[model samples]
Target: MGRQWRDGRGKLVVRGESGDVTLPLEIASSLRARRRGLLGRDFVEGALLLSPANSVHTFGMRIPIDVAYLDRRLRVISVRTMKPGRLGLPRLRARHVLEAEAGAMEGWRVRSGALVEVDTDGGSDAHDRPDSAGTPSLPS
Candidate 1:
């Protein structure tokens, strides 16, 4: 029901009624990588994905960000634009979190119930963290 991805670069594809939107993706699966996500950087190339995460904070960030909480199925649970110096509420159903520049998600058709696909450099890893979920990972 959850995904186990390694630290790498890839693409995040969001399919919507309009069309497919692809964006550069950075996978943050390690504790260190996920902890340093988008911090201290002026901006991001596209998006950063934090696996096994349910919430995020922007206490020291320089820029605003668009955050999408995804459930175990990669379906968006909710989307929010967070300003600097804010702590996001944890979504009980979220198993992964996607962060992008402020206002970027709106144009990408990222919203509640939207299904997403992560294409890692070596292909998507299918596994589940016992503490995170109990079913298969990303859709094949």
Candidate 2:
């Protein structure tokens, strides 16, 4: 992500050793969007990224999810799988939170220490635009 990201749809690109993983991304930069994240969604087509957040809860969620906490530079500080009705502790170093269907992070190669990029300029022809470095799937 950049210094500033607005609430919208975008793309998340993970730079893995094997290759780059690009997935659909929903950005929740505003307080309203971030607070209502994935609460009623049965499944996430890709992933939801909440900025300026260090923790999350699945109080009203319908499915389990994989959560990854990211630091300022977009480096994943930790990743965990959380079931519905559970609460995740805040990571002191985390500046953002990523949520996806349970187990989707493994398939997408999102792990601790991984780096990600957010592409908010996802148009018909915007691919591999390294605006800056640092930035999932459905449930059963």
Candidate 3:
């Protein structure tokens, strides 16, 4: 659930639910979040932005993280672990990127087809109402 960037032959250790993986950094660079609303947060731990067919490098992180590779259309193509201070090789068709706490994806059931919904409005819908028993109703 953390990230580590690499400079050379560094080791990345990701502690998973059942086990762990220590791998080398394929590509290394400074990772920053570009989403609209994440600016004020103290720090972004597990997040990524993939370019179209480019490389990702990690050289200055302290923890391990999970990386999700997305295609140009923002569809997840693959996922893997990147240890601290390593590099991720270029994926020819990669477009978007997502990083998360190690093993969090599996814990949250996040998969290729799972949709990521960004709420830009920052407001709740008026139609969101409670049912007869005071239970919230689902969106139509």
For 1-140, candidate 1 gives per-residue lDDT tens digits of 34588988988889798888888999999999999998887788889999989999998899999999998778899999999999999999999999999989998899998978787754544432122354544444
Cα shift from native, residue 42, model 1 (Å): 1.4
Candidate 1 regions with alpha-carbon error over 4 angstroms: 122-140
Q: What TM-score would each prediction reach against the true structure? A: 0.86, 0.86, 0.48
Note the residue pairs that clash in candidate 1.
1-135, 1-136
Error of 3 at 130 (Å): 31
**lDDT tens digits, residues 19-105, model 3?**
544333222233433222122333444343332234444556555566666554334567777776678776665554556556765
The backbone clash count of each candidate, in order, is 2, 2, 27
Q: Which residue pairs clash within candidate 2?
A: 46-136, 116-135
Prediction 2 TM-score vs. true: 0.86
Give the Å error, residue 115, model 1: 0.6
lDDT order of candidates, top first: 2, 1, 3
Candidate 2, residues 43-101, lDDT tens digits: the string is: 79999999879999999999999999988777889999999999999999988899999
